[model samples]
Target: MTNREKYNQAFIETLEITADQLGDDLTYQSIEAWDSVGHMQLVSALEDAFDIMMDTDDIIDLSSYPLGIEILKKYDVEFS
Candidate 1:
């Protein structure tokens, strides 16, 4: 899968959400499934999928779907 596909998959599996549900509005604490536990799950999924570890600051800053894409880009995980 491409980076975009893997990114979507992480959110899908971690949030127990559908691909259609992902968007800029999808954020941490914005939904029942995106609690602290779910956030870590998503982080783990992304790390594993991208083969890169994220810094604590990056993890905390990744508060939204759009922001997550930005954070990953810092690690060279291009979306397109």
Candidate 2:
């Protein structure tokens, strides 16, 4: 899968959400499944998918879907 696919997959599988549900509006606690536990699940998924360890601040700052893309960029996980 591509980087974008992997990224989306991480969110999808971690949060038990559909593809269409993903967007800028998707943020932490925005859905019933995206609680603190889900957030860590997502972070773990992203780290495993990208093979990079996100810093503590980065994890805390990953409050939204769009921002997650930007945060991953800091680790050189390009989308395009």
What is candidate 2's lDDT per residue for 1-80, written digit by digit as tens?
Answer: 99999999999999999999999999999999999999999999999999999999999999999999999999999999
Clashes of 1: 0
lDDT of each: 0.93, 0.97
Question: Where's the lowest-lDDT run of ten residues in candidate 1?
Answer: 71-80
> How accurate locally is residue 13 in candidate 2, as Cα lDDT from 0 to 100?
97
TM-score, per-candidate, Cα-based: 0.96, 0.98
Candidate 2 pairs with clashing backbones: none
Candidate 1 error regions (>4 Å): none
lDDT by residue (1-80, candidate 1, tens digit) is 78899999999988999988999899999999999998999899999999999999999999999999999999988877
